[model samples]
Target: MDLGIAGKRAVVIGGSQALGLAVCERLAQEGVNLVVFARDAARLEEARAHIRRIREVRVDVVAGDITSEADVDRLAQVTSETGGAQILVLNTPRPPSPMRDFLDETDNERWRQAYENQLHGALLVLRKVTPLLIGPGWGRVVAITSASIKQPMPRHAVSTIFRAGVQAALKHLSMELAAHGVTVNSVAPATVITPTFRPPFHNVEERVRAVPLKRGGRPEELSALVAFLASDLAGFITGENIQLDGGQTRALY
Candidate 1:
């Protein structure tokens, strides 16, 4: 698959490890110059080294918390100095504790924090990157959201709420940005095997029972879809929340 995005510049938020890293790896393979952002300086450096070893594309690492306004400003500054990012991948992690019941977890602070992490961060990134996308006349923005937005997950109240907000925001942004040739879309995955989050399921059998595919998804599988969405082939696709959940949400409809 010739993604038709070689030489394009990209910024992958939370790209130090797990699904973020997988997306970076796939994009790098397609010859996209990448700017990977994450809080862990060591992990970001390590990711850059690993990607360089495997691909010929240039990879720059930005160590900063996506939730910080200063960090996001710095990312825009650094990217502009080189060349603004044409593809922006918002792949930040959800807050740690999976409090099942929304009523039990009535901590307003927790909800605020989760919103800042998942939704605000992407909004900040997109706001700063909009000029770049407009300048290029073509861009791809894909948010790595969760399938919970489509059908709420059992013990993921924060993700269910916050990711829904993200989807809503992206839906509006897609329409607004379409005139500039920038497509805004999201990819929602079910149970991708990532180290960031621990699934409540006790075993593979339990997880497969929920998915019609009968198994959890691999990082590569999710990454491939993300890469496709970021490609020129996906130009006509916008305002969509494509689920790569292996039929897990089939029962919802």
Candidate 2:
């Protein structure tokens, strides 16, 4: 099961801990050099050390918030200095709150922040970094978005709205980048247990109660899917939102 991406450079946003770190470890296992980005410098260092322990691949850490344009610019500059990256994992942090109903979202500022942080900020990174991939005529853009894009959760309004927009943007980018041999796709996971898995609406047991499997997905399980999508093996796949939910989402598409 050689992914055929060994030694290739990848830039993973929010790669400090939890699912991001899991993705990094999987990529490192595949021998991919990494540029892991997050706001926490200390956690980034810890992730670097942990990944190095997994494999001897080059692991560079960049501390920055994706919501900040200046930080994203700095990330691109640093990545370019390291010979640029062929794979870009756009994994930003979730919206501030656990979950909120659309009608209850009275504060207009929350909507603005969600747009900036979840949707626009991701595009900022893509705008700055996708060019690096274009030059090589080979690229992978796998965004770790939520399953709400397909099956919207009851109380999750902010994340669903912005992430669905992000999905649409990626689909558009897929067609635009097809000629360049670059694929743009997203992984939508529902109830994946990570450090920040707490949703105010439901606890772990209650969250997976409706799922046919009666269990939440594991981080490594989601990470494996990400690693595959980021490899040459998934070269033909693009403009798709593949869900990693354990029969939780009923929608066929």
User: Using TM-score as the measure, which candidate wins?
Assistant: 2
- For lDDT, the strongest prediction is 2
- The CA lDDT at 112 in model 2 is 89
lDDT of each: 0.85, 0.90
lDDT (0-100) at residue 188 of candidate 2?
Answer: 90
TM-scores, all models, native as reference: 0.94, 0.97
Give lDDT: candidate 1, residue 114. Answer: 86
In model 2, state the lDDT of residue 182: 97
Tens-digit lDDT string for candidate 1 (33-144): 9999999999898999999887979898889988899999999899989877899998957664656577777888888888889888878887886567775579999999
Q: Note the residue pairs that clash in candidate 1.
A: none
lDDT score, candidate 2: 0.90
Over 1-253, each residue of candidate 2 has an lDDT whose tens digit, in order, gives 9999999999999999889999999999999999999999998999999999999999999999888899999999999987899999999678867567899888899888888889989989888888889966899999999888898998789888888889888999999999999999999988889877874634877888877888889999999999999999999999988999898778978
Residue 123, candidate 1: C-alpha displacement in angstroms: 1.4
Give model 2 RMSD, 1 decimal.
1.2
